[model samples]
Target: MSSAKRILLTTISASPRENVNYQFNNQVAIASQAPVALIKLLPIHELPDKVIILCTQKLYDEQYETVRNLLLEYYDQILCNTLNQRPDVTEVRIPDGRTVEELWQILEAVLHSIPHNCELTLDVTHGYRSFPFLYFTAALFLKALRGVQIKAVYYAMLESEETEKPIIDLSLLLDMVEWFYATRIFHHTGQASPLCELLRPLETPPAGVTGKDNAPYQLVKSIRRALENVSAAYAQALPLELGREAEQLLRRITQPIPRHMEQKVPLATELFGSISSFAGSFALPATRQRRIRIKEVELNLSELTRQSSIIDSYLKQGYVNYALGMIREWMVSCAMWNQMAEESIYRVDWWIGHKRFETEHKFAVLARTAYKADGNTTRDIITPEQRWLASKWQFFSDKRNQLAHHGFRYEYVLHSPQQIDEIRAQWEELKSFVSSKPHWNLEIKRGQGTLLLSPLGLSKGLLFSALHHIRPDEVFVVTSEESAISIEEITNRADWSGRKYVYKMKEPFTGFAEAKTISRELQNYILKSDRIIANITGGTTAMQYVIQQVTQDLRLTGIETEIIAIVDRRTPAEQVETPYVPGEIIYIEGQGRLNPPPND
Candidate 1:
């Protein structure tokens, strides 16, 4: 822990007006003597452990001793003649500050002279022309690098014609600078805690702030709530909530402010003016977009645009993980918007329709598989342009998964020599993506989801082929005691990210296995998906017969079933050499309890 002290930093100048009636007019007790020099006023008021006077060559020769003698006289004459107890006064010589290099030298001198974590106060009353800007830059650096707390910044306006000059306190500007940083953090990283702290500087509002009569307090609280709500909504990637909060925040920000707010909170109207501009640019009109109602989803062009802007802001700030996660969702939302028809879909009808989550899930499936799948294979649900877009997002999804999970399941470090380059390409494409409206000629019709059930055996490629080809939503594996290792083998090579169910039949090859017992065990697990794909390509004859019986039992409950076999096209030698590769899928139809008969 580094220690800190109350230190005042000021500059000396050889101004001709030395003796004048300098009455301290402000409410703050900054100076003890009414007629003290502007540079010495802070030293007299604070009586810090140390006082630093920055001066140039001529000022040091002419004006430095006069200021030093006044400080000594304060202790010797005014305070019972005790001169030894005066604060340590040090003179730091700086350049003339005529050139940029000289300005840097002056800043470096002040920075090095100041200790770490000091309650710092700066007197900008007199210095070279460049000293004020250079001093402020140094203060910013010290606050960040050295933990310096800027207590006050004083400026005496000698330009006034009267003998009494007013000392203006410019420390309020420093607090406003914090507001700029708060808004920037909110925009870039979707964070708002800094704004929260600034809004309520004290633990509670000062004294009499109880009810609606205190309009300023109520308004301030409203402003804080609105801003924080919008920031949090963006952080959670909730588009609906973000739009609602942003639009509401905009309405409050644009409301008329009380004229006397500036008297209580300094720069009150000006403060809200800045916030108005910020909120208007980022979050206004979010919920005001014309919502088009299709079958089950309502699409808002403006809301989607706002969401894209948030993602772009996060990406520009190098929050790559946040951007990646939102892009996948943004794609799904765009697909829903693209489902509009010429006359079938109602335009600008804000009333939300049915099956939103279900339709969105189906649309996501369509967007992911529609592009690569043949039009016939997809039942013409996926468009050619959609396939092109999905192809662009191929590795981005995988990359997002890797980042989200921190690659815990990976065998090696999740990296590739060409990975960053590929991501750079993806970034460029995504930039173009957010800049434009999502376009897909998708007619969102609910499609039957796939479910793959198989038995584990000597060959793992059979299950791998069915999973890759079918891309099931739910999976079930029938494994025996001996074939438990076979499940691990298949999963190690197969990238199947879906919910799965497994059963351990003790004797997989036993002919004495009871059909009633197997069906009862299978029936205990309720079937949600209507379509079932039973890959009877692995396991022994007994296991195969048991799975067949289970599929027949599932049909009685109205679940559609497809019994399939994988016939390896490769010969025994080739199959042994490349066992992980796929073969051909033979689909055999099995009826389930009437599921609307597929057509009507």
Candidate 2:
């Protein structure tokens, strides 16, 4: 019944097969000739490569010899074997599964009987009461933990001598169970790859599978990329587009599946509610979204409240490390917002413009000071409730640093985790305090328009074409020393004249941390909610990646940002009538339209 190298697992039944006649496809295996009806299901006179017989002491003592003789007689006579080669059968001893301990022993025996990650075929035709359940449970364990693939599970029904019994393939039931776990994982972690794989088979109908059977696969395929994008947003800790991305996934799943589909497809349809629920968890209110669309969101109260909701989600889902770092950084951001609120505009302007690093270092120091100091020393920059939140940051700050520098935190004598109720109360209080605070969002004057951030790569034509197409008022360039040989060629162009330019020179190589550090600095030059375009079409692979991530983060910092990679063509062509057509501009972050080059 099994293919080469596939293990067939079955058990010996004490029931009298002597009176039974199992017939299928003009092949019959009588109870007198065969130990089990499983022999009848073999594919056209073929023996299994390996057979694992689940045996118990009482069962073995009574039926072992009879079963052995019947199998040999059937294989020798019916199979017409001349070489005398038999299936490599192994009888493994197991408990009878009467008590709890015996059931555990039976489960362990089933696991020990198989090779790791092997292809398996199971026959439950002659199992005892708990035997089938125990074996099936073991199969699920092997699948989830050991990467084993269960090829088939079959049960042969016995009814009458003249009747042909049906062999029910229960493999579909097992697949549904796996899909259940995968869907739950997607719910908890926002990861969709597992469910995506299970649904991949349904993408195109199998040979015999057609019509409504393909509905779930089509539904999943449409949203597969969106699902992964939402997962990536969560995994990367970028909340700027998380709500929108989650909504996209939710919308796609809400698309109606064909009615009365198969079992596996229904499981996906049933998951629509959970998808909507989890996606709603990351949603921002219309007011906040509108405020985001306008100016003055940077270091803003509403945006911080939105982030707290995401942190709340992580906490509820038991992602402490993710919530931990985000919580402490929230404190730094709150302190900067506080500083901007308390200090004058001139001081803020001078601090941020002349000493950018010093400005960031000062805000970090102020946050720490505000956290440690409870008196009037920080009252100018931090409110009393804000100080309390800052104190909460104190706890996460240590935990975050400890996680980064050391391993797990060891709890010694007189150490215990905070009470669950106490933690919940603190989080609720923090959320309430952050939500009630006023926003110190700054407004930009007119004429402060678009800013273009592009990496300096080879091909001045590419950058120049982008400038005219994007038509930004200011430009921020990240150029490697090697690419700067012809830097002046693009810098001195009359087409790009009347715009201010600032260049960052670095080694040809840029690491992730380095790129992230530099990307954050762009926030200074960013006007209030100004349109920022990150042209990643030019730069190293590392630059392209981190810039997208940082620009997404920039959106959370109260600026409008989009990531686009421009290319001449997907497939290169030799002759182009328009060399500076600017090719294709693909938006990586949010929706954006490609502009045609400017005219006289």
Per-candidate TM-scores read: 0.62, 0.58
lDDT of each: 0.64, 0.62
Top candidate, metric lDDT: 1
Q: What is the alpha-carbon lDDT for the whole of candidate 2?
A: 0.62
Which RMSD does model 2 reach against the true structure?
17.5
For candidate 2, lDDT tens digit of each residue in 519-578? 545545553225778888776766566667667565544456777776775333421333
Best candidate, TM-score-wise?
1
Q: Candidate 1's residue-wise lDDT over 440-525, tens digit each?
A: 43332335566678887766777777766676776788877677667656665666667777777777778436555665544323
